[model samples]
Target chain A: MKVESLVFMLITFAVITLITVSLFIKVLKNNKNSDEISEEEQ
Target chain B: MPKNEQWGTRVGLILAMAGNAVGLGNFLRFPVQAVQNGGGAFIIPYLVCFLLMGIPLLWVEWTIGRYGGSHGNHSTPFILDKMGKKFFWKYIGVFGIFSNIAIAAYYCYIESWTMSYVYHSLIGTFRGMDQSQVAGFFSDYLDVFTSTTGIPYEAIIFYIICLALNTWILSRGLNAGVEKTAIIAMPLLILFGIFLAIQGVTLTSGSRGAVFDGTVGLNFLWTPEFDSLLNPKVWLAAAGQIFFTLSVGMGSIQCYASYVKSRKDIALNAMSAGWINEFVEVVIGSCVIIPISIGYLGIDKVIELTTTGGLGLGFRTLPFLFQQWGDLLAVLAGVSFFGLLFFAGITSSLAMGTPLMGFLQDEFKFNRQKSALIFGAIIFLMGMPTVIFFNEGVFDEYDYWAGTVSLVVFALFEAILFAWVFGIDKGWKELNKGAEIKVPYVYKFIIKYITPLLLAIVFIGATIRPENDDWSKLSFSGWELHNESIIGQLIHKGIKYNNTYFSDYFKSEVDGVVDSVYHFKGRDYILISYIDEKGLTHTVSYNYSGNELTVNLGQIVNAGDIIFKGFVINRIFYIDMARLLLLTMFISISVLVYIAAKKRKQEKENK
Candidate 1:
């Protein structure tokens, strides 16, 4: 039971991390070459 | 002087609000509930709520804030007017403020629990506490926590400390006060949480593998327990989990959003905050609670402990587990765990305070400092019952009424008001104006259909059923022992049964399981069936002798042994799916951003 619970939690972490990282990476990639916006635009 | 100010930056708003949204409940309640409910299975509903409802509602609140802009100070009234229902909802705006005030009172009392634990740890009071002793200590601790005749000095001190901390930050205004705290505290929380998780997993018992293949550990947590899901308890828990954990339906989110720069991307930021909140609150929290519960109490006890008497599981059960680790380790674990808990509570209290602070400033036009202090005093007074009152479970009532039911209803109301009535067209313009990345049309669909519908169903399920009051009565059988006198023990050795081999084989399979099973009468029997070494099916009745099972075989059947390999495969599949979906969303976003960047670059080059 303990093993199963741990594996599940680890898997959950992995999933959340993967999604978070992926989304983050996408945001980074999209914004990587873009010019910074002025304060007015922001 | 500048009326209400925008957050100096988005990051601070995210942190402060996130800090408020994430709490001890998430860290404390979520994992225990997951562990006991079937680990992976619970994650299914949890993740569903996160994506479908939590994020979208966040977007709704943010949209309201940014669209109203300077006028957003009066969130409920402003939105109601815009939606052409100023009369009805003007009063409802107070719901969030009222809930925050009520919650703030009890929140301080609860936060003081951490202070007590901190003081006790430093004094080494936990050095000799066993499970029962620890429970007794907590009961006694509450006596000092809540004063009967007026406010107790100790309670006053901590209450003052919490209120002072909140007031000082508000005086700095949003940038210096809320944002600065969020940036520093949120990271510390994550780091501390990660450090504790590492320590917990490294412990001797924690690293050991699971007990059962299905619905018991990793697989059980994710694997859909359709049977359990069908029950109202599961649905209600899932709803309450979403409501409380997100810190929604309280106007808190709206208050924070109100300060956001008009051009900031509501959808993206909301998604980011919601995503981060769930990761810290649900995922990391589960990491801490599950392994510890499984290591100490076994799977079944994890369930009972989770469902035990409101939110006292963290205070009562965790201390007992800490004691089991012996003196040095126990003290260290107790200090570190509770220390992490303290920060989590403080951050949440700060977050809850923001909405109330905003409402006060907006409605009454008081400066932030004065508003925070005046409201802080009110919450402190209201919190006395939660701290001092023992019999009525005042804290639990506050948690259920304001935290659970009220939050869900308010959240639903907010979503509908924003998406349908307030006009998504205006919201879209506000969200996309300065957004570096445009929100997809899909966000509109989700805010309109997906988010509202999901919340409604979950709310109905959560409120329609009576909550489980006595979750402690549940128990599981591991061994059968007859409690007899020394002489009577000898006489019970002659007890007979039909299938004796079942007990013997079962005992042999498990080396030294705990004696959890108990017999009803002097002599009680159980029927057991399994395939033998030759792959022939057999049935037997077993009479438990002392802590042993004596099986009596009734038939030697010739069917092959039932295969459990499929259940094993299904378990792996669901876990992998959850992981895949989470990763896919993240990766897909990254790839799209990359493509979008390339497209923009090409356009720039041509220009």
Candidate 2:
């Protein structure tokens, strides 16, 4: 890939990682009480 | 404002979006502009805009629209209020309303031309005319129609009919009018397109000449002349075409998406329409524009001839070419061609009117009927200039200001506001919910970066003011050179379809493909070459023989027999490699990410 494209991919990876982390953190906070149901179901 | 009780169904919302996106931009502008600005080269930037610009902007519109609808508000200002922006940005909403109205005004008038052509073609008045004569006929018709007492009556009558139909549908609300028309028109357009493709093939058999001449057909389409590509003017045109073609940033889509339920997936729908539009432009559109142009102007001058004017390129040129080929086949092709055009014009015009009507109802609290009528009246009255003057200067002005500049600026502001101000995270939650396919993490990546970058490039590139051409210049850059060849050739060959008449008059006299050996046979032909795995070359002749390809291989050809072919040799099969790779990458990444995230969640729960 060209330098420009490589840079774009890096930027994309960073953005997606940040967003996923943010969402994951939010999901954990919102569903903290539901963790017992998850473990029991498993 | 009324509650969400009157909004469109999911299907209605999809249709409204499709209706807005798939208008004259697809049918009228794309084919002409693609040929004019270096065919395959033009697609490069266009694809970039779609991948980077169009999809993201659509997502922004959908997110904002659904959010605002839940609160029952209209456009940028209403939505921004909740997003914590001050009243100053409400100006964007007002600007959007003006842009839509301006677009509709001229769009309706151009739409009227289709109705007029349909009436003329159906009545057999366009039959048996040479180029100049046909040109004269159109000019005379325009003169008679635009005069205080002239053919403007017919134009007005149809204009009102189309306008009333639009208003009546909008008044019926989204499902009854907008969605219904989209579903019906979409199918009809496809069916009619198939019919036109069928007719186009049949026209290949008669005496016209080499139908595959690239001068206007495939050569003008795919042949890359790098000089044209490198020109800043070409890039500007490509940017302008992308902006106009997708209907992005127009509030046309935002207004329609406003009616969509929060759960309905806007991104997927927008992508679907965008892909369909690209397919039609490259495949069906190229098939029509190139073959017809090659048959008339030859390969070299095809570019020159098509560069005259966008409307003149397809509307005036193709009809005259059909007349020249003269026969039962020609007559059928002529009717199908115009019918296809009429369908395209109507679908697009409806989309243009939607945003105008929506803005009025949302901002001013006008009922659907009142909004539709008042908006429709304004469009009809404004369209008068295009109808009455018969000059492209006014049309060009409207197209430039409302179609390109205003639309993109609005779209850019929308993207910025959605991604940064309103917050991208909220959009993700709504988009992900109930998606049959799990939302890939990369979508977030695209939304934040790829899409915004593309829009910025297209918007900035499009607004680059031309240094050479004055805004007031009436003459198109390439018009004189192109039109001269057309007139000169028409004068030399007086007959429309009679090969004997043309050959006798112009034989040994003209320079282009007209003097070549292939004149009488309608120039649409196909040459198929297959190189097998064993290094054996198979050359075949495929020509339109009575509405079907008559394939002669000079060897035994068997159906359902395993003929081991080593390599697929067509340009058609090769060009799709990049898009296929991108699709695969996207799918694979999404799947892997989803699986990894699910597993991580399971581990965390166990802990």
Candidate closest to the true structure, highest lDDT: 1
TM-scores of the models, in the given order? 0.71, 0.67
Tens digits of per-residue lDDT for model 2, B519-539: 113433333445545444444
Cα lDDT, model 2, residue A4 = 41
Tell me how many residue pairs clash in candidate 1: 31
True contacts kept of 2: 0.00
lDDT of 1 by residue, B493-578 (tens): 21232113122222222112122233533544444465555454443433343433332234222222221111112222222333
Model 2 stretches astray by more than 4 angstroms: A1-42, B1-12, B74-77, B144-152, B198-216, B224-234, B324-328, B390-392, B438-440, B466-607
Per-model i-RMS: 4.8, 13.2
